[model samples]
Structure formats: structure tokens, C-alpha cells
Target: MYSKVAITGMGIISSIGKTVEENFTSLTEGKKGISTIENLETIHKDVIKVGEIKLTNTELAQLLGLSSDNNYSRTALLGAYAAKQAVQSAGINAINEYRTGLISSTSVGGMDMTERYFYDYFKNEAVQKYITAHDAGDSSHKIAEYLGLEGFVSTVSTACSSAANAIMMGARMIQAGKLDRVVVGGTDALAKFTINGFKTLMILSDTYNTPFDNHRKGLNLGEAAAFLVLESDAVVKEQNKKVLAYVSGFGNANDAYHQTASSENGDGAFLAMEKALQLAKLDISDIDYINAHGTATPNNDLSEGRALIRIFGEKVPEFSSTKAFTGHTLAAAAAIEAVYSVLALQNNVVFPNLNFQTPMEEFDLMPQTTLKHKEIRHVLSNSFGFGGNCSTVIFSKN
Candidate 1:
């Protein structure tokens, strides 16, 4: 058996809140963060809602104490903010003292700035620095530099499941005696590119998203960042770390690399959950709460619902999707949901799946529509992305 990687600390900034405590409060209070587009100038501003952070790029950079000329994109700024908070939460003054590393993920990367300066690059040298920040890896590097970390730094860009994979990779590395501790998560900032891209796919909800509901429309694009400090058992014992949770298991699978739009038995999601249960050495019933990847889209809810029914048979545990609270945060979806999973275990509560009135006709899977307190020892979080990327990670009480 692989050693369990302990989650020493976590940090998050999303539409619901800027801190972990705030997010938890929002979840417990059933406060939905879906709102109108405030920062982004898009044509769908009046037609669609999004889980957007109200802070501006300037405000974020100032919060990080970045210089005026720093080339950090909005994605990097959001990532550094959350990562620094995670390091601080973990009580790590010397980030590199324990062979530390950072694994950050992003789908948009620096596209927020790229789209803004795509035309002005040739005429304006002032915005030219952002050209180098236009890729996914640059955001990870920026996050590491901000954290003063000098170890294995890598980036994962598996679209929506990016952060879950990052968390999985970090835990595996630590269990394999490759690193002592690692910070893993993802960040994404709203961009016209993504907003318009989803709009083109006709999945942007005009009002609140209703996950698992039959009348659900689609997902609302959102931007946020979250990070978790994962430490090996030895490091936790050596430092007497206050373990918040443990990365009990993780699994990833693809449905023949996409073409899963028809469910096909939720091939990828089913296998991913099955593998995660096998890795955790737990039965399918051990999962007390499920932070579902319910994006409120017709395809996703039906597909994921079918997958859950297939796995649990008649004993599906209490599950809810927090996406209605934070919209679909793409790359950061799994990271934020991972944080929510740990919060559920810590507080012994199941967060509500907001804006649901009716269950799907095809399945009897009705999600928990209100906050329910329970003995949540283990939580299974799912994140399925485009190109058939599907990932599941189990977080357990430490």
C-alpha cells in the first residue's frame, strides 16, 4: 500500500469567498456567488451569469506586493495569492527546507491578458511583457517564484481535471520518496477567450446553474484559485503538523479520448471512481459525501448521474455539486471541490447543490439540496474535462 499523503493546509479564493473560512461559511449558509459579469467586458454580460471574483488585476497584484512592471498575468496573480496563503497556513517559513515543490494547473493560463493585448502587442511596448506570460507553464513558474520555492515545479493542463491530477501527482511523488512536501492546485482567470468559447458551445447559463436538475440549462464560467499543502507522513510527524485531511486515493481515466458525449455508461468517470476506491482500499460505500463534477449541463449531469448509479447501485451516498455555488471553474474546478471535500470531512457537513427543483427523468439521482450534517469520513470528488479527461480523488479525515 502507498503511504497516505497528509494535507497540512489549504487556501482558496473563489466567487464565494477569498479565504477558506469564508468559502466554508458560504457553503454552510447556502449563499450562492453567481452574479453578473463585472470585470469582463463581454457581449453576454447582460445575458449570462458567472462566478467572478470582484477583484481587479491591479488589486490582485497589489495584494501580492508585486511591482508595477511585473509581468504576472491575472492567472499568476490569483495563483500566487492562494499559494502564499497555503504556505502560510501550513506554517512554513522556509518553503524549500523540506524538499518542497509546487504543482499548479490552469486551463486559461495567461489567456486573460493575451486576449486583451493580442492586438496591442505591436503598437504598445508597455504590454509586450505579457507576451511571455501567455502559456500555462509561465503561471506555474510565477507561482513558485512568489512562494520562494526551489524544487520540482511543474504544471498540469488537463482542462477541467487539471488540479485533481496535480494533487494526485504530488501525493504519488511524496509516497514514492521523491519529495517531502508539495503544494498542488490550480488557478484560472476569466477571459474573453473562454467566455466566448463556452458561449459558442451554448453552455453558458443565463441565470443560476442548477446541477443534477432536469430543467438545468448549463454552466456559468468562473475564475478562481485554490491550493493545498500536502506533506508526507514523515514530514507531518517530524513537524507535528496539524493534519487537516489525507489524500487517500486518486484515479484518472479517459473515455476512448473523448466522444463520451453520449455517456456510453459514463465510461471514463466510472473507471476513475472505481480506480480511486481500489487505491484507497475502501469499498464503494465508504464514500460518505461526493463533491460531484456536476456542471449543470445536460450532458454532464446525465452522464455523471449514470456513472454514480452504476458505481453505487442502490446505495449512492449523499452527494452534491458545489459548482452552482462557484460556477464551473474549469481547471480550478477540482481544486476548489477538493477544498470543499476536505471541508466536508472537517465540519461533518454535506454542502447543498444550489438551484435544483426537479430531478432528472432518466435517473432517480436527486442531489442533496440543503446542507446536511453527517459523519463524513471520506469524500469522493469528481472532475471530468474535455477530450475525455476524467479524474476522481478521495479525501479522507486525517
Candidate 2:
């Protein structure tokens, strides 16, 4: 069996807030970050709402102390900003003190710049520096460089499930003795590409997303970056690190049922949750809360709802999706949700699932709609993404 991986620290920058504390406040207070686009310029600005970070690229560059000549894309800047917080939160002055690695995920690396300079790159050499930042892995490299990490750096692009898988990989590496510590999560900046992509799917909600509601229309795209420092038990003991939570369970499975649609019975979601519970060696009853992957999309809610019913039978615990507060952050959704889950465990409160109304006709699942205070011990977070990727992570109070 692999050794248990402990989450020492977490950092996040999302549309809701720039720091973990701010995001937590927004989550608990039912304050949403979704609004008209402010930072990104696009033709579809009026039609689609987004969870933009509201910081200009130049402002972010200045925050990172980069010169005007720097070629950092918005995604790289956001990733670096959040990763730096995670490293600092972990109380590590030297990142290379042990065998450390970084596993970051992103569906849109530098598309914000690519879309802006698609035609300008040929005419202006100054903007050509951003051409190399267009790939998915490039943002991870930039974050690694910013943190001075030099081992096992990689990126995963499983659409919305990217960060959950990144966290999963980080935990597995520690379990397998491949690395003593790893910074794991995902990042993505708002872009016209994703706004249009979800528009094409007819899953871009005009109003706030209503996950698990029968009248749910679609999701609001959001931008965010979050990272969790996963360290082995030995490393935690050696460094006297404070454990935020224990990543007790994790599982990833592909639906293989469709390219972008979940199976009618939520086969992949069911398997992933089941596998996670098995790995955690806990019964379903032990779970206190579920941060569901309720994107408010019609297909996703139906599929995920069925899966929850099948897994928990009749005694499912209180569950809610924080997407209403932060919108759907695509690849970074799982990572940010993981951070929210840990916060729930730490504070002993379950954040409300805003915008929820009528229960779905297909299932009787109703999400917690108010800030419920209770002794939270273990929480389960689910994140299902496009391309049939489904992931589940269980975080326990340490």
C-alpha cells in the first residue's frame, strides 16, 4: 500500500477572491464572483458571463516583479501567483530541500494571448515571445521556474478534471516513494476560446448556474488557479509541517461513453467514487459532506445525480456544489473545490450551494442550500470533466 499523503498548505486565486481566506468568505456568505467580463476583451463579452480575476496582465506582471519585456502570459502569471502562495504557506524557505515536483494542469495555457496576437505575432516581434506559451505544459514550466522546483515537473489536460488528477498524481508519487513532496493543482485564465466552446455545446448559462436543479440551463465559465502541497508522512514529520487535511482517497476513471457526455447511469462517476471509497477504506456512511461536481449542466447533473443515488443508496450526506460562487473554472474547478473541501473540514461548516431550486425529476437529490454548521470530519469532492474524465477525492480532518 502507498503511504498516506498529507496536504500541508493550499493557495488559490479565483474570480471569487485572490487569496484562500477571501474565497472562503465568499463561499460561506453566498457571494458569487460571476459577472460580465472585465479583464478579457472579446466580441462575446455581452452574451456570456464569466468569473474573471479582474486583474490586468500588466498589473499581474507588476505584482510578480516582472519587467515590461517579460513574456509571461496571463495563465503563467496567475499560476505563479498561486503557486508562490502555496510554497509560502507550506513554510518552506527552500523548495529543493527534498525531492520535490510540480504537477499542474491547464486546458488553456496561453490562449488569452494567442487569441489576441494570432495575427499580430507575424507583424510584431515583441508579441512573438508569447507564441511559445500557447501549449498546455508551458504554464506549468513557468510556475515551476518561479518556485525554483526542478524535479518531475509535468502537466495534465483532462479538461475540467485536470486538477483533481494532478492532485491524485502527486499523492501517488509520494505513496510510491518517487517524490517526498509535490505541489499539485491546475490553472486557467478566461478566454474567448472556452466561452465559445461552451456556447457551442449550449451549456453556457446566461444566469447563475443552478447545479442539481431541474430548471438548470448551463454553466458559467470561470478563471482560477489553485495548488495544494502534498507531502509524505515522513516529510511532514521531518519538517514539523502542519497538516491541513489528509488526502485519504482518490480515483480517476474514464466514462468512455461519449466524448463530452456522461453515461445515462453515470457509470464513470459511480466507478470513480466507489474506487475512492475503497482506497480510503471507509464506508459511505463515514462521509460527512460531498462537494459535488455540479456544474449545473443538464447532462452533468443528471449523470452525477444518478451516480450518487447508486453509491449511497438512501443515506447520502449533505452535498453542495460551490460552482455558483466561483462559476465553473474548467480545469481548475477540482483544485479550487479541493481547497473549499479542506476549508469546510477546517471550519466545520458546509457552504451553501447557491442558485439551487427545484429538485431534478429524475432523482430526489437536493443539495445543502444554506451554510450548515456541524462537526465535519471527512468530506468527499467530485469533479467530472469533458472527454469522459471523472475524479473523486476524499479529504479527512487531520
Candidate 3:
């Protein structure tokens, strides 16, 4: 059996809240964060709702103590803000004191700035500095610099599953004895390009996203960042850290079915969940709650529902998707949901799936629509992304 990786700290900044406690409060209070776009200047501003952070880019930079002249993209700003909070929460005075690393994921690294300066780069030298911050690894490096981490800094950009895969990779690195501790998560910011891209696909919901509902429309694009500090057992014991939860299991699989749609049978989803259960050394019944990857899109809810039935038969544990609360955070969806899973494990409560009224026409999959108190020992969180990327991470009480 692989040694369990302990999650000592977690931080998140989303539409619902800025801190972990705030997010928990929002969840418990049934506060929905989805609303019409306010930060990004998009043509579809009136037609599409998004879970955008209320803070402006300048405000975020101020929170990070970045100079006005710095080329910090919104993605980097959000990532650094949340990662620093995670470090502080873990009581990490010196990040380099341990063999530390940072694994961040983002689909839109600096696109928020690039789209704004795509035409001004040649004429304006002031904005040219952001050109180098346009790649996927730039945000990860910025987050590492913010945290004073030097070794094994990397990034993943497998679309929406990016953060879950980052968490999975962090756990594997710890199990393989490569790093003593790693901060894993993802970040994304609202941008006109992404909004238009989703609009072209016709999945941007105009109102609150109702996950798993028969009348469900599409997803509400959101901007947020979240990070978790994963430490090995040795490091946990040596540092006398307060363990919050354990990364007991993780699995990833690809369906190769479509570029933007999951397979009809959710093959990748099933395999990923099965593999996670096997690694956890726990039976399917041990998963007391599921934070499903319920994006509320017609295809996703159908496919994910089928996958749950395949794995759990008729005994699927209580499950719900918190996307309605925070909107679909794209690459950060899994990371934010991972934080929610840890919160559920720590608090022993099943977060409500928010905004579901009708069952699907094909399946009897009814999500937990109200926050229910239960003995949540284990939580299974799923995040399925484009290009058939499917991932599952299981968290247990430590």
C-alpha cells in the first residue's frame, strides 16, 4: 500500500467566498454565486452568467503586494493569492525548509491579458511585458516565486481536469519519494476569449446553472483559484502538522471519444472512479458522499449519471454537484471541489447540490438538493474535462 499523503492546508478564492471559512459558510447557507458578468467586458455580458470574483485585477495585485508595473496576469495573481493563503494556513514559515514543490494547473494562463493586448503589443512597450506570461507554466512559476519554492515546479493544462491531475501527480510524487510536500491546485480568470469560445459551443448558461436537472441548460463560466498543501506522512510527523484530510486515492483515464464531449457510456469516468477506489483500498461502499462532476450540461449530467450507476449499481451513496454554488470554474473546478470534499470530510456534512428541480428523463439519478448532515468519512470528487480527460480523487478524514 502506498503511504497516505496528508492535506494540512487548503485555500480558495471563488465567487462564493474568498477564504476557506467563507466558502464553507456560503455552502452551508445555500448562497449562490452565479450572476451576470461584471468584471469582463464581453459582448454576451447580458446573455451569460458567470461566477466571477468581485475583486478587480488591481485589487488582487494589491492583495499580493505586487507592484503596479508588474506583469502579473489575473491567473497568476489568483494563483499566488490562494497559494500563499494555503502556505500560511499550513503554518509554513519557510517553504524551502522542506523539499517543497508547486504543481498548478490553468487553461487560461494569461489569456485575460493577452486578449486585451493582442493588438497593442507592437505599439505599446508597457504591455509587451505580458507577452512572456502567456504560456501555461508562467502562472505556476509565478505561484512558486510567490511561495519561495524552488524545486519541482511544474504545471498541467489538460483543460478542466488540470487541477485534479495536478493533485494526482502530487500524490504520486510523494508516494515515489520525490518530494516531501507539494502544493497542488489550479486557477482561471474570466476572459472574453473563453466566453466567446464557450458561446460558440453554446454551453454558457444565461442564469443559475442547475446541475443534473432535466431542464438544465449549460455551464456558467467562473473565475477562481484554489490550492491544497499535500505532505507525506514523514513530513507530517516530523513537522507535527495538523492533518486535515488524506489523499487516499486518485485515478485518471481518457475516453478518446470527443474533443469536448464525454463518451455515451462514460467509460473514462467509470475507469477513473474504479481505479481510485482500488488505490484507496476501500470498497465502493466506503464512499459516503460524491462531489460529482456535474456541470449541468446535457451531455455531462447524462454521462456522469450513467457512470455512477455503473460503479455503484443501485446503492450509490449520497451525491451532489456544488457547481451551482460556484459555477463551473473550468480548470479550477476540481481543485475547488477538492477543497469542498476536504471541508465535507472535516465537517461531516453533505453540501447541497443547489438548484435542481427535475430528474433526468433517462435516469432516476436524484442529487442531494439540500445540505444534509451525515457522517461523511470519505468523499469522492470527480472532474471530467475536454478531450475525454476524466479524473477522480478520493479524500478521507485523517
Which residue pairs overlap in candidate 3's backbone?
A: none
- Which lDDT values do the candidates have, in the order given? 0.92, 0.91, 0.93
What lDDT is obtained when candidate 1 is compared to the true structure?
A: 0.92
Q: Per-residue CA lDDT of candidate 3, range 141-228, in tens?
A: 9999888888889999989999999999999999998999999999999888889999999987888899999999999989899999
**Residue by residue across 242-291, what tens digits does model 1's lDDT show?**
99999999999989645435255788999999999999999987899999
> What TM-score does structure 2 among the candidates reach?
0.98
Local error of candidate 1 at residue 368 (angstroms): 0.4
Off by over 4 Å in 3: none
Listed in order, each prediction's TM-score against the native is 0.98, 0.98, 0.99
Residue 280 lDDT (model 2): 92
How do the residues 1-398 of candidate 2 rate in per-residue lDDT, one tens digit apiece? 84458999899999889999999888888889999988877777888777888899999989888899877778889999999999998998989989999999999999988998889888998888888789988899999999988788999999999999999999999999899999999999998898888899899987888889999999999999999999998988987889999999989899899989999899999999999999999899999999999999999989999999999998989999999888899899999999999999999999998988799998788899999999999999999988899999999986
Q: Number of backbone collisions per candidate, in order? A: 0, 0, 0
The TM-score, computed over Cα atoms with residue i paired to residue i, of candidate 1 is: 0.98
Model 2 local distance difference test score = 0.91
Question: Candidate 2: where is the Cα deviation over 4 Å?
Answer: none
Per-model root-mean-square deviation over C-alphas: 1.0, 0.9, 0.7
